[model samples]
Target: MSISSAAPPKPTQVLPYATKDLHEVYTLGTKLGQGQFATTYLCTHNTTGETYACKSIPKNKLLFKEDYDCVWREIRIMQHLSELPKIVKFHDAYEDSFFVHLVMELCEGGELFDRIVQKGYYSEQEAVKLVKNIVEAVQDCHSLGVMHRDLKPENLVFDTVEDDADLKIVDFGLSVFYKPGEIFSDVVGSPYYVAPEVLNKHYGPEADLWSVGVISYIILSGVPPFWADTEKGIFAQISHGILDFQSEPWPVISDSAKDLIRKMLDRNPGKRFTAHQVLSHPWIVDDNIAPNKPLGV
Candidate 1:
């Protein structure tokens, strides 16, 4: 959709958050966050006063045709997932001469990674609740032919700080629609959480589940199962690294939890459990475990 330029608002000179590339429908608030290609700001509706987050990306920075199309793809993907549960809600978007503005639901609880760091850890029971929500989101995405190329704790956010808050998966910049068995060649994702097949540049939706495995390991241990001092070492570890479960915290972790990770992190992508399969895993489906135990150390 194109922006309507029907009537220019008078007193345009003093327009706050108004640019040729953005609309005055949103009144800019405090700065929320910034990233490589865009900066997010808290915004409010001019008439409704409802809060939202506006991602402002400079159009000039899109030097290549692919870069421009990538943004549009993100918009389309978000539109497709507009009503999906456990996902950040997308409102609408606008483009002016300078930037593309994508308005999304404002999440107040911040990143799941921050919670993991601050709380020291979560029990398998607690982690199960979180992972189940995430896997369901992923399963939904896959069902719709969407592949979240980048899946990590950093992209997971909570709707609020409440214990029962919904854990929503956000960000779709690297996401794409792919059919089952289709392959992708471009390498994309955070180094630590990427699947081994992603490094090989030939992978499908199962690659995302591998990242889920990495996230599962992190949620239970407060540390990634694989790590290295350098990027090369990290990649080496991902390709042939031994998942460390013999250390301190592993003894206390339930075997079911470890087994879940093992199946997802398997080197062979073909053998990795899909998101739907993960939901039925013993670790995720068992809600009868004893009270939540802290495994943060």
Candidate 2:
């Protein structure tokens, strides 16, 4: 359906919309996923028969009151990048008296982490392809001045379960748009993947690259580069930027791959490679090169 038929969508929250209007335009289906403040459902347009992922956020949640603007920002960011490759599509945001609805592209495959675990073992070539798609998605967002503060395995999904399906980056709840040279102050993102600057509450886009580096380490090694028995321990390890390559997988992985991860996980934000640089790095762009003999994955 031409979203033109319904009331024009707003980038931010509007007054409670009519429940009837929602039912009139789209047929809601099964529950697809859940979050801290909302649940996503499968839905189809009444006229267009187009399928979409609808995130439903309850108005009564305390989180809604605190991060109301963040929700709107997430919607707007998705809207801005809807047409960009490797980024999840955003169709619309609808609100009623009780809840807000976010319609977006449906990612059918499971999380990248889950897929890797299921596959049991993955090659360096496979990791390279996955990282390329992920970097391109982040690069697109960075080009638009948007920072996906939270980029983890849970947020990366494939279009389908097919072997060659394209990967997509999703979830922009912690994202924020900023001007060049401006420093972001909010401390956000999962502890393990967060950049050192974020821990100090002073950071920028490079902070996100650090997260990609964390993810790169996990995908390639079949395990996280940093870990501890407790949350405090994990954060401490992250702060120190200590990673061990003595494990079985580490010894077998190619030197170039390890080099790229090190560059991305650099303690100094100034030295960390940006998304563009990561995409062009020798490890990521070189196809003929083979990975380590025993891909711990």
Candidate 2: count the clashes: 1
State the lDDT at 57 in candidate 2: 79
> Candidate 2 residues 1-297, lDDT tens each?
555565333333433333345777899999988988789899999999989889887766733334666676777888888898788888888787677788899988878987887887778888888888899988988898898999999999998899898889888888888788879888899978888899888999999899999999888776788888887888888888468877877877888888999999998899999998898889888877656343753
- Model 1 lDDT per residue over 32-110, tens place: 8888989999999987999999988887777766677788889899999979978899998887767788899999888
Q: How many residue pairs clash in each candidate?
A: 1, 1
Q: Which ten residues in a row have the lowest lDDT in candidate 1?
A: 7-16
TM-score of 2: 0.90
Angstrom error at residue 185, model 1: 0.6
Worst 10 residues of 2 by lDDT: 7-16
